[model samples]
Target: MRRCPGGRSWRRAAWRLRCFRFVKIDCYSIETNIQIFAVCASVARRCGYPNRPDRGGGPMNFSARGLSAMFSVLRQRNFAIYTSGSTVSLIGTWMQRVTVGWLCWELTGSGAWLGLLAFADMFPSVIVGPLAGAAADRWDRLRIARISQMLGLLQATFLFVALVAGFLTIELLFAVVLFHGVVEAFNQPSRLALIHSLVGRERLGAAVAINSIAFNLARFVGPAIAGVLIATVGVAWAFALNAMTFGAFALALAAVSLVRDDALAPRSGFLREIVDGFAYSVRHPGIGPILMLMIAAGVGGRAVVELLPGFAADVFGAGPIGLAALTSSVAVGAILGGFVVGVRQSYTGLTRTVIVSVFGIALAVAAFTVTDTLYLGAAALAVAGFFMVTTGVGSQTLVQLAVDGSMRGRVLSLHGLIFRGGPALGALLMGVSSEFAGLRLPVAVGAAILAICAFFALTRVNAIADALENEPRN
Candidate 1:
C-alpha cells in the first residue's frame, strides 16, 4: 500500500478522504491509518485526492507502535498549543463551576435556588444559540472565541471581587451567571466549529477525541482541586483562580492563527442563514439521527451524574466522598473512551458504535438505579461514563463529518445545545420524577427510553451512511 506523502498518520486522516465510499474496513486497516491526513487539507480546497487515506488497504501493523499512533493529532503545531492551554483553562472552569454551586448552596441553602441558578446559566442555549451560530458564519470565529473568553475573565473577576468584599447577593449571583451563559452562547459554536481550521478536517475526529480527553481530565481534577481550596482557603479563591485561567486561554487563542475561508460559504442574511442551516441539517439523513441519539444521551440515565449527591447520601450512605468518587470514576472512564475515539480509523464502525454504546449506557444506568452498595454503584457509573463518552464523541465526529463548511457552525451549535442543554432538561425531569415516584423509577424509566431511542435512531443512521456513501462529488 502507498503511504501518504507527509509523515503524519494517514489512518487518522483517512476518514476525511476515503470513508465516503462506505467500503468495509477491518481492525487492521482501521488500526494503521495512522495519519489523520498526511497533512491537514485546506478546508477550502475543492474535491481532489484525499490529502491522506480515508481508507487504507494496508496489511496489519498490530504492534505496540499502533497505540502511540492513536494520539497522532497532537503532532500538529497549533493543536498542541491549543490543547495545552485548554486543558489548563478547563480545569479552572470546572473548579469555578463546583465553587459556584457550593457558593449558591451556602448563600441560599435551598435546592430551588440551585435549580434557578442552573436555569439562568443554561436557558440561553435555547434563546441565543442559533444567533450565535449565525454570527460564527459571518464573522471571524477566533475573534468571537477570544472575545468570549475575555468576557468570561471579566465575569470571574467581578464575581471574585464581589464575593471577597461581601458585595454578592443571591440575585447578583444569578445575574453574574446569566452573563457567563450569554458569552458562552457565542463562544461555544465558534470553539466547536474552529477545530476544523486548527488540525484540518482529516484529523477532526482525533482532534475531537483528544479534546474530550483533555476536558474529562480537567473535569476529574478541577472539582477536586476546588473542593480542597473551598475547604482550605475559601470559595473566593476558586473564583479568582478561575479568572486567571481565562487569561491563559485568551493568550493561547492569540497564539494560534485560524485560517479563514470566506468564499467557502458565502454570507447571507443572519436570519436566513440560520434558517438555511436548520434546513440543511434537517434534510441530511445522518445529522438528524446522530443528533437524536445525542439528545437521548443528554436526557438518558447517564445524566444521573447531576443527581449523584442524592445517590451518594440517601442511597449509598457514603456522603460527599462517595459523590466525588462516583463522578471521578466517570471521568476516568471517559478519558479512556477518548483514547478509543481518537485512534479509531473507520466511520463504518461508528453507526454500530453509536447504537451499541447507547444501549451500554442504558444497562449501566439501570444497574446503578437498582444498586444499593456504594462501591457497586460507583462501578456502574464508570461503565456508564465510558459508554457515554463513546456515544457522545462518536456522534460528534459523525455530525462534523456530515455537514458542509457553511452549516458547520450552526449544526454544531445545535449539537452543543443538545450535548450541554440536554442534561439540564434531564435533571429537571429526574428532579420531578423523584418527587413523584422515587429516585430509582425515573432513572429506570429513562434507561428504557434510551434503549428504545437507540434502536429507532439506528434505522435512520443506516440510511444516512448509505446516502453519504452515495453523495456525488463536486
Candidate 2:
C-alpha cells in the first residue's frame, strides 16, 4: 500500500500541512484529501493570510482606528482580562440557555412551559436580589463573584450529568434553574460594581458599552453553536462545554487585581440595608424614572427574546436553525448599538437616546410580530435588539454615573432585578395569554404597552439628563 508523504498518518498529515505540499495524489483517498485540505486551511489561517499585505491602506487604517476607539476601554489591563474571561463564560451561558429552551420545546412543545422555564431562570431575582445586593455591599465583591462562578460551574456540571443520565425532568430543571437565578442575583451586583473600580468614572460608559458588546457577542455565537450541537450530537455536550466555561471565568476572576478599593463595612442589618436600597432607588430622580422605563421595556419588549422558540418553531415553522439565526441577528444589532455607545466620550444626548430606544424597540417588535416572513422577522428583531442594547447600556451607565459609592451594590442589584425579573413576569403573562389569543397578538399588545410607557418617559428626558450626566456631589 502507498502511504502518505511522511511516516505515520498524523505525522505525515502534520508534515504535509507544515510544508503545504501534496505529492502523489493518487496514493491518498478522498477522505485523506479532504482532511489534508482542512489542515492546510487551518495552517493558512495561523500564518495570517487573511488580507493582502498591500491592503493595509487608508481605508484599512481608518477601520483599525475606529475599532481602536470602540475598544479603548481594553487599555485598562484589568478590564480587558475580566472582559475576555466573562465573554467566554457568557458564551457558554447562552449556549446552555438555548439548549435548555430547545430541550424544553422538544419535551413539552408548549409555549407555557417555555415561559415557565424562563420564569424559573429569572424570578428568583425578585426574591433574592435585594438581600444579595446587600451582601455585595457588605462583603468582598470579588470573593462573592469567585464563589458564584464556582457554584455556576457546579450547576453546569450537575446539569450535564443529569441530562446525560436521563434524569433531568422538567421539574428538576426548574429547580436547578431557579438556584442559578439566585446565584446570579448575588453575582450581578458585585460584578457590576467592580466596573467602576476597574476603569473608574471617566471610562465607565465605554466600559459598560464594552461589557454589553461582549455579552451580545456571546449571544450571537452561542446559540448558533448550541443549535448545531443539538442537531448533531445532543444537549448534554452543550451543558458539558458550558461547565468548562464557568471554570475558565472562575480562574479569570482569581487572576484580576483591583485598582480601586471598594471595600465597605456593614453599618446595619441585611433587611435594613435591603430596604434602604429600595428606598434610595425609588427616591433618586434620574435613577428612579430610568429604572421604571427599564421595567416597562423589560416586561413589554425583552420578554419576546425569551419566547423565541415559539416564534421559530410555531410562527415561522423554520425549526432550530431559524431560532439560532433570529437570536444571532438580535446580537448583531446589539453589537452595533454597543459600538455606537462605546465610542462616545460624553453622555450628551444619551438620555434622550434611551427614551427614543424605548419607542424604537416597541415599533421594531411590533413590526416583527406582524411579519410572516422569517427574513423580515429577523430584520425587525435586529432593530428591536439595537434599541434594547441602547436602552440597557444608556440607563446602566447613567445609574453608575449618578449613584453614591456606598450605595452602588444595592442600586445595581435593583437594576439587575428589573433586568431579569421584568422579563420573567412578562413572559409568564404573555405566554399564558398566547395559549388563548395566540403568540403574535399578545406580543403586539405588550409592544403597545412599551410604546405608551416611552411616551410618558419622553417628558422627563431633560430632568434625567441633568441628574445623570452631571457629576454626583456626594
**Maximum-lDDT candidate:** 2
For candidate 2, the per-residue lDDT at 342 reads: 70
Candidate 1 matches the true fold with a TM-score of 0.81
Q: Which stretches of candidate 2 lie over 4 Å from their true place?
A: 1-66, 263-266
lDDT of 2 by residue, 156-239 (tens): 999999987879898898888888888988788898888888988877877999999999999988987886676556788899
Query: TM-score per candidate, in order?
Result: 0.81, 0.86
Off by more than 4 A, model 1: 1-63, 106-112, 259-264, 317-320, 435-438, 468-474
Error of 2 at 312 (Å): 0.6
* Clash counts for the predictions, in order: 15, 0
lDDT of 1 by residue, 1-474 (tens): 112335568764673354332222212222221211111112101111112223211122223564566567787778888888889889988887767766775675544455456556665776788888888777888899889889999999999899888789999998998888778877888888888778776777778988899988887777667755664467788899999999999999899886534234576678898888888877887787677777887888555776665565567764334445566667766766676566665555565566667877888899889889765675677667767887788778777776787778888888887776776677667756676576678878889999898878666655866654334211
